[model samples]
Target: MPHHPDLATTVRIRLIEPDETDAVAAVTEAAYSHDYELPESYRRSLLDVATRAAHDQVWVAEDPATGRILGTVWTPLPGERISPLARDGELDFRLLAVAPDARGRGIGAALTRHVIALGRERGARRVVMNSGSEMVGAHRLYLALGFVRLTDREGPVEVAPGRFLDLFAFGYDLD
Candidate 1:
């Protein structure tokens, strides 16, 4: 399918590859700031898993003009946390991010839909994601995309002063 012309004039979504690991990391670092402090090792591990040929599936949105990665998302099949409602099949969207400069341009929404489509293609009956409380906008987007909040848990790990954010778990039935 062609890229959404209205949102990303010359952007295209493609499966992420090993060579694009650095670009994916760059986009992740640029998209998330002050919210979560991911250690270098954690980032490396995520990238490694995302690029792995096994169960991980990563996708990227590239700007045809600059040939740079504008956004990316990855799903881990056979989710880590299995909910009773997701016993059939599910795809956990581990990460969804768009470059700061690429925000408000529908890039995030496009990437999200792309991931959902990917899940459906992989025979997933539902798509799940964990959104931090600090990501209000993202939570709103998920809601708009028909994702319903299943539950929320207070983060035990404190990253900042007195700011104990909660992780809101959202799920979307692909059927």
Candidate 2:
């Protein structure tokens, strides 16, 4: 995996340690729950940081001075992709969430910037993520950060048995 033990970000971006799994999971779930009515399975998935960490790398954005986690996001290990939205040479990230209380502090943006850096460092031609249509704020952020909508990848994703969420795809070209 790529290591950035000392990212010089105002909001420190680093791996989510074992002890912080609960905190990060809470932030992620709370952030999403505020906007949507999550099904039991989806809610459980949001709270299961360990499984995400086991599959990819879970990262947290923290208040540098206080060491408090403000947000969380996960990306597949270098040269890997967890979301089908990503094609070869693309790095895909998912579950980006900033604690409701921490919004407007740029924690989300910082985490995204960190992910972009990770993609560039890993020699990816692009970085991609899929977001639900309800996440308007997140869409603005992605666009402001230079991500473009990927119409071809937009579709409905099953969040639970016989249930679905309309997802839109976005990509940041790093080339």
Candidate 3:
């Protein structure tokens, strides 16, 4: 893919450093809130996952000019064999988001590709993400990137009265 100069020229993706944890959490909360009403506790739980070694493999895309985080994706490293769909291996992608003001500049796609590359390098057979069904745009992007719908599961939490989340699990085979 040709890199777009207008989309923050010096953008780079790197492992999340300890100091950027708060910024990562803030961006995740802000980004998700745009599409869904996440409970404070859920947001906090997401943030807390960054602190746990076994569950954390976060990456942040930063703007080189101003040193601001443009987007981030949290991917868990490959672990015990999980399922047939996880045949290649598994890297659970969570909390992927681009800053609101930075949308449409390809940051989200760039981040997704970055994580896929990371998964390949780490010997992951596949990369998976659970996205809300209502996030049509994101689902489209995932499909565009070669991710196939594996299954759908009910979200663990309900954000509205009589309303439950339908989370779609998508996967991309690395090999």
lDDT value, candidate 1, whole model: 0.70
Better of 2 and 3 by TM-score: 2
Which pairs of residues have clashing backbones in candidate 3? 88-125
> TM-score per candidate, in order?
0.75, 0.92, 0.80
Query: Which residues of candidate 1, in runs, are more than 4 Å off?
Result: 1-5, 34-55, 77-87, 152-165
From the highest TM-score down, the ranking of the candidates is 2, 3, 1
lDDT of 1 by residue, 78-155 (tens): 444322224447777756888888877778888888878877888888887777767888988888888898764234
Q: Taking the tens digit of each residue's C-alpha lDDT, what string does model 3 give over 42-145?
A: 77766673564345577889998888998888766556432222443687676788888888778888899887887888888888877777888898888988
Error of 2 at 123 (Å): 0.3
Better of 2 and 3 by lDDT: 2
By TM-score, the better pick of 1 and 3 is: 3
Error of 1 at 19 (Å): 1.7
**In candidate 2, residue 119 scores what lDDT?**
93
Q: Model 3, clash count?
A: 1
